[model samples]
Target: MKTIDQTQQEIVEEFSMFSDWMDKYEYIIDMGKNLEQLPDDFKKDEFLIPGCQSRVWLVPEFRDDKVFFKTDSDAIITKGIACLIVRIFNGRTKEEISKSKLFFIEKIGLVQNLSPTRANGLASMVDKIYRYVK
Candidate 1:
């Protein structure tokens, strides 16, 4: 299994292959398309993330000192972005996730390229992940 940083680097390289933001968006949308569906039971209000324009449900499981996240979003772009986060941080130890920085977001210019609402939503998604890992 890859470390979180290694997974992030892989994602950055993947995004770097895209020449334009539109292509990157398409890539993200495709990633979202491949995300595993969250069970209807997991999509309850208690798991809902705040400060998002769309409904996002995030659930974390801890087993044998590793954390695994299961998440879903109502919007396609948001789902895609969540898929990226889940891919990076899943199956990591709490120690590994505690001080992690999602540098890929900035390295890929995702923070600047996203609309303010989507960016805030992304931040909220990440914040929730950190909170869960803690």
Candidate 2:
């Protein structure tokens, strides 16, 4: 499996291919559309992430010493954001997840391009992931 940094760098390279933010946003929406659906049973309020402009749910499972994540969001862009995150951190070891800096978010200029509320939601998502790691 690719190291977290390798995966992040791959994403950065992919984002660099976009000519503009609108294209990037479209790519993100496409990614979200391709994300595997989280089960209805995992969509409970307890799994809901706080501080999001849209409702986001995260469900984590540990198997064979790796953590796997399932996420869903009410907003397309937010779901896309979750897709990026889940693609990176899911199925990774706790040690790998804990040590990751997730530089791809900034490297892709995703955080800067987001609305303030969405940025907060992103932070909340990161926090929720870390909480699960612990």
> How many pairs of residues collide in model 1?
0
Question: 1-134 in candidate 1: lDDT tens per residue?
Answer: 88888999999999999989999999999988888899999999888988787888988888889888898998888889888888998888888998887788888877752344654477777877788767
Largest lDDT belongs to which candidate?
2
TM-score per candidate: 0.91, 0.92
Tell me each candidate's RMSD, in Å, in order. 2.0, 1.8
Model 1 lDDT, full chain set: 0.84
Point out where model 2 deviates above 4 Å: 113-119
